[model samples]
Target: MRNYFIDLLTKEAESNNKIMLMVGDLGFSVVENFKEKYPKQFINAGVAEQNMTGMAAGLASEKFHVFTYSIANFNTFRCSEQIRNDIDYHNYNVTVVSVGGGLSYGALGYSHHAIQDYALMRSFPNMTIYAPGTRSEITNCMKQIFKSKSPAYLRLGKTLPKNFKKLYKPNHCAPGKWTKILECKNPDSRKCILTTGAVIDDAVQMQKKEEFSNYHIYSLPIWGMQYKTLQAKQINKWDEIVTLEDHLEDGGFGSYILECNSNIKTAGETKIKLKSLNKNVCNTVGDQDNLKEHFKFAH
Candidate 1:
């Protein structure tokens, strides 16, 4: 995805000439290609994320297509106020490309995790949230953002699974009410597993262990599907609508489901069980799976 995103940006920057690439001092070798190709357009804003976001907004106000780049939390979480007040509030044409969306830096602990970006960004009025399932989808997402009139947010994974390329299309038809369901080996199963990101593969793995009766995995991009209708359907057909993701329980995809259902009352929660990777900063870690296991997100 990094290779694809960088190359895409480079080509666009060359053609547009008015685009600016601003970073919060995080992109090292990953963004070197862009920095080299368009030296004048690329600016390393050091570690001041808030200031970086503000500067991006100022640049956008000049009719420049401001492109802000950084790792998950540092780019989105740190400068949220700037993003809200300067960009979303003003409806500026700023494109924020967030890498390591979920747990790409799982070994780096909580400081690096971008668990709540989707929920936070979705609440802003003039923001368009996009989460692609593959590299091709990412390219489509870029083109999709270009057609929008408001601010844009693109959530991405640094290390994506192979299944995404074969099973997904990188395009933004819309954010909410946009869902794509892939057919599993079995079609009659009433079980519809709702999941996103690489963790969807985990649900598929669970299915191979024991063919879950009427169980089907649905890859729902961020803010995808109508939660009210989905809730009603899940209650009637399937006994479980498991939500799995590499994010915190609160302020993540699970909360998005809760936000949509205004009248749902299931013991202070929605029907979807909020399955998320723990958000606590850890002192011990080996890999992404180790972190999920230590946090008890294993299948």
Candidate 2:
């Protein structure tokens, strides 16, 4: 996904001279091609995410569509003040791209976990939050946001799926503003697996013929999904919901539903019981698969 963004952003910059990129001393080999190609547009601002964001806003205020890149916390949390004040506050045309969104750097421990990024970033008005599940979703999402003037947050996972080239239909959200239900089946069981990010994989598996054969699946990858509409959709579809995410419950997928901000969450809080499986930090060592299984995203 990082490679995909670098490629897409480079392409966008070539065609639209208004686009600019700033990095916080990260991206290593992933952003080399982009940096080499557009040296002027690409600024390696060292580890100062706050300064980088201010620079992005300065460029955006001048009508250049700017983007600030870094690890999730650096991009979204470390420089959040700049994001809120300079971009989101005035509705600047800036895109905040953060990698290692969940536990992408799991072996590196909790400091690398972007568990609270969503909560921190979403607090600002006019900010749109997106978590793309597939490689295709990443590029397509960038395309949509570049054309949009609203400030946006693009939450990308650290690793790409094995089938990186395959196109998975974006769960109705498709680079849109808020969450959308991707797929649903097995209505008789009345249980819904509500997921975001790559947990879509687990949710799909759960609804498989034998695993959770009787339950339904719903993907709300985008944050701030309007609750009223989501509620109406759920009422027309399933009964109960269990939020599945790779981040903490407070400010990620589960919290969105738990606070009644989600249509599904509201219904669950008011009518049906709500459950969540989330993590506040990297709870284990090994690869991504191990973490997923440990958290019950897979079994």
Which candidate number has the best lDDT?
Answer: 1
Q: TM per model?
A: 0.82, 0.83
Report the C-alpha displacement of residue 143, candidate 2, in angstroms. Answer: 2.6
Task: Please give, for residues 1-299, the per-residue lDDT of candidate 2 as tens digits.
Answer: 78877888888878887878888888888888877878888888888888888988888889988888888587887777888898888999898988887777666666677777777866877887777776656655776687789788888887765543432455345432334333444435666666666555655655664755655655554555332244445443545566666676666666666555344433443333333334523555545566666666534
- Candidate 2: regions farther than 4 A off: 162-191, 208-211, 225-236, 260-286, 297-299
lDDT of 2: 0.68
Clashes of 1: 4
RMSD of 2: 3.6
How does residue 174 of candidate 1 score in lDDT?
44
Q: Write the per-residue lDDT of candidate 1 for residues 95-213, one digit (tens) a residue.
A: 88888877677777667777777777877877876676555556666776766656888777765555664454534434444344455566665555666554655665555556443
Error of 1 at 23 (Å): 1.4
In model 2, state the lDDT of residue 250. 69
Candidate 2 pairs with clashing backbones:
231-263
